[model samples]
Target: MNLRWGVAGLGRGASFVEWLSAIDGCEVVAVCDVSEAALQRFDGLQTYSDYSEFLEKSHLDVVAVITPGPEHATQSLAAMEAGCHVLSETPCVYSIEEAQAIVDVARRTGLKFMLAEDYIWMGWCQNLKKIVDAGKLGDIIFAEAEYTHDCRGGMLVDADGKHYPASAWGSREDLTPTWRAADLPPLFYCSHTLGPLLYLMQDRCTTAIGLNTGAKVAPEVCPVDMESGLLQTAGGRAIRLTNGFCIAHPFSLFTGLYGSRGSIRMVNLGGLQVKAWFEDDPDGGWQDLAMEYEEREDGHHWVTVMLEEFIAAIRADTDPPVDVYRSMEYTLPGICAHVSAEQGGKVVEVPDLRKS
Candidate 1:
């Protein structure tokens, strides 16, 4: 069945426009952005600068929010309340309370709510999950994942290969500081780094402790550009994550998984490498693996995969692949980590939203 779609927040939402417009069973019924300028780029569609009006008028079955990270929870709650399924871009909400509230909403509405955590669908992550599920990795002992993209205070690059300040794009008619990434604590965006590992482990972090790598170098909101932290799972497995967006570093997702018998690593430097090892191997050695995967002739691999699964779940009238429960499991630790940093690296308990 074809699904009617509306996208809110058109900066990044513009890409959602192109993507959904291309999907076979979806229509871009309407689009919204606080910026009238951003809406102009998407021709021949209903557009609104205000979210409430967009929801009320747009004939939509689902609304994907690609706006600022901070606005996600409120916009998602609005979409669901308006009878639209929600697909929110990462770090679904900033706090456990927000996470719990959205989970409750999805349950009450009986609608699909999926966090667009693309890292979980990335080729290396999927492959690593496969290795673990096959028991080649044995019982997982510990894991480390990092999302280190140094924007150096909102360096948002455009299609022409020119870099612009993030605030410049997110700003409105007044040009106030609306750039989400500028002031956002790095840890607030940790779902990308933490989500895949949690997805692979099939576990939730029960507790988290964080260290703030002071924002004396920070460009905006929080005083810290990076918040490094450790999370402990209910099963006692340890997970480490760092949301390092401020410091000077090449853009890379360096993920490592350590299990009782085997391990895997995704190293992104001059190029990408997927390396792994198993205890039963003759040499018991780490070796580089093939990075090749089935290519998509039509669209972006991870995004297309995500959209198909989302559509399939809706069509089947079944739970989404990444449902609300799993969404919190991937998102809450980062929220807790931020709290921990605020409290001077104190361990903050991560509430399990799945618990009744």
Candidate 2:
């Protein structure tokens, strides 16, 4: 069954359209954005400046919410209410309240509500999970994940030119206004680094202690504000997540897992290295087990994998790997991490969303 997708937010939605255009069983039947100029890029598809109007008129099976971080909940709820499934971008919702609302609506509607956390679907990350589950990494203990990018220049440009922060794409007049008219925390954009580790471990993060560097290097550039969080899981695993608009570092998104018997580290978008350390001999030192590269013309193709999984879940009548609840679990740490940091590095207990 082909999944008819109505894509929202043309900036990032353009990539989804490009990917769906290539996939056989998926179709971009409708597009929506506040910017007519951006909507004009797509030909022979229904376009709308208002999302509510698009949902009411478009014959869509799924609405892909590729809008900014803050707009996910409202748009997703609207789609679900309109009798369509929703696939939203990472960090599912800006706040726990919004997350709960989306979850409640999905349960009541019995429609698929997936969080597009593509890092968990990366080829290298998936391979690592397989190897670890196969006892190649023995009993896992500690893991570290990082998502660092030097977006100072971009932040400065966006803030000065548009009078909004770098990550505030929704605030752009060209985009639809689905976000709450309130300020958002920085650590909310951290699923890319946290999702992969949680999936590989196959366990929820029970507790988190976060230390935020309350340093606003360029307040003018990042007027929305930002902070970094260091989280420690209940099982004594450590995950350091950093998200800010004005950091002075090269872009990096990677995870390193240390187990009782072996270790594996992956440097995504840098060198694409997935190396494992295993006990080679009883008397000797450890050895490195490297993963062979599978070349894709367009890098990892994570978003494509996510869409494929969504379509397969629809066909199989089962929840996707990154379902609403599972995705919520992955996202909670990011939310709590920010709270922890704001509270002067205090440890915060992540609410058990599975229960309530």
Candidate 3:
């Protein structure tokens, strides 16, 4: 069945138009953004500055909600209410309450709701999943993941909502801090670190405890420079997550999985690099693994693969891989972690929204 699509928030959502237009049986019919300059970039497609008007007039069967993190839940609800299936960018929801609401709306509407989480679909992550499933990783007991992207330069935004380095605020009088810069606890952005690990383990976090470096860097613009979360999964496994977007470091995604018989380390230092060790390795040393997979031909492997899967789920009228429940599994623990950090490392329970 051919699907008509509408994309809200052009900053990141613009990519969806190109992707969906290339996918078979999908048409990007409308684009929406508050920025007229952004809307102008898509010359032929229908465009709207107002979200409600876009939903009402777009004649869409699907909506990709790619706005800022704070708008994800409400935009998803609105899209589902308008009879459009939703594919939302992460972190899907900020709080347990928001997660529960998304689940309720999705259930009531019987619409496909997918969290557009790409990390799990990366080649190395997929490879790790295969190793674990094959028992090569053998009874995974502990894991560590870190997303240490230095975003200090983009902490503050100008009058037009364009981001500039926080260091540039002194040279400009009208600069204001972004919400993530001023109020977002680093742990709240943990989906990138948690989602793939949860997917690989096929588990959900039950409790989380965390701590943060209390605005040690860029104190006036950002609340915390780094935060760490220790999560206990339902399967009696432990996962450690470190998230820091404001520190001085090169952008990186790193994950280490420890198991009874073997271990895996995957890091994205500009490019994917994978290393592993097994009990009977020929030399008993870390073996470097290739990161390329057959799916790389599909263009932007992770994003393309994830989008195609979401579309396939919709076409089959089935739950998406990262459906509402799984999205919460990948997202809510981070919120719990943030609460834990705020409470001086007190353990916080992550609500299973499926049971709510």
Evaluated with lDDT, which candidate comes out highest? 3
Off by over 4 Å in 1: 153-178, 219-222, 292-300
Q: How good is model 2 by TM-score?
A: 0.86
lDDT of 3: 0.88
Candidate numbers sorted by lDDT from highest down = 3, 1, 2
Candidate 3 residue-wise lDDT, 74-172, digit = tens: 999989899999998887888888888889988998998988888788766777777899998789999999999889888898778788987886788
| Residue 33 lDDT, candidate 3, scale 0-100 | 91
**Candidate 1 structure lDDT:** 0.80
Q: TM-score for each prediction?
A: 0.90, 0.86, 0.96
Tens digits of per-residue lDDT for model 1, 1-356: 67999998877778888878888989998999877777888779998988899999877899998988888899999999889899999878887888889989988889999998877776766767678889998998999988888675545544433445544644533333324445477778888888888888888899999988776553443357678889999988999998777677868878888988888887777578888898899987888877633233333587778888998898888988899888888888887888888899999998877784
Off by over 4 Å in 3: 292-300
Model 2: per-residue Cα lDDT over 1-356, one tens digit each: 67789999888789988988788788899999877878889879999999899999988999999887777889999999998998888767877788788888878888999988876666666677678888867777877777767654344223122334445544554532123112345567778777878788877776666665454664433433345666666567766666654566677766788888888777756567666677644654544446533343346576777788788897787998788888787788788877777777787888766677
Which pairs clash (backbone N, Cα, C closer than 3 Å) in model 1?
183-221, 215-218, 215-223
Better of 1 and 3 by TM-score: 3
For model 3, state the Cα shift of residue 87 in Å: 0.6
TM-score order, best first, reads 3, 1, 2
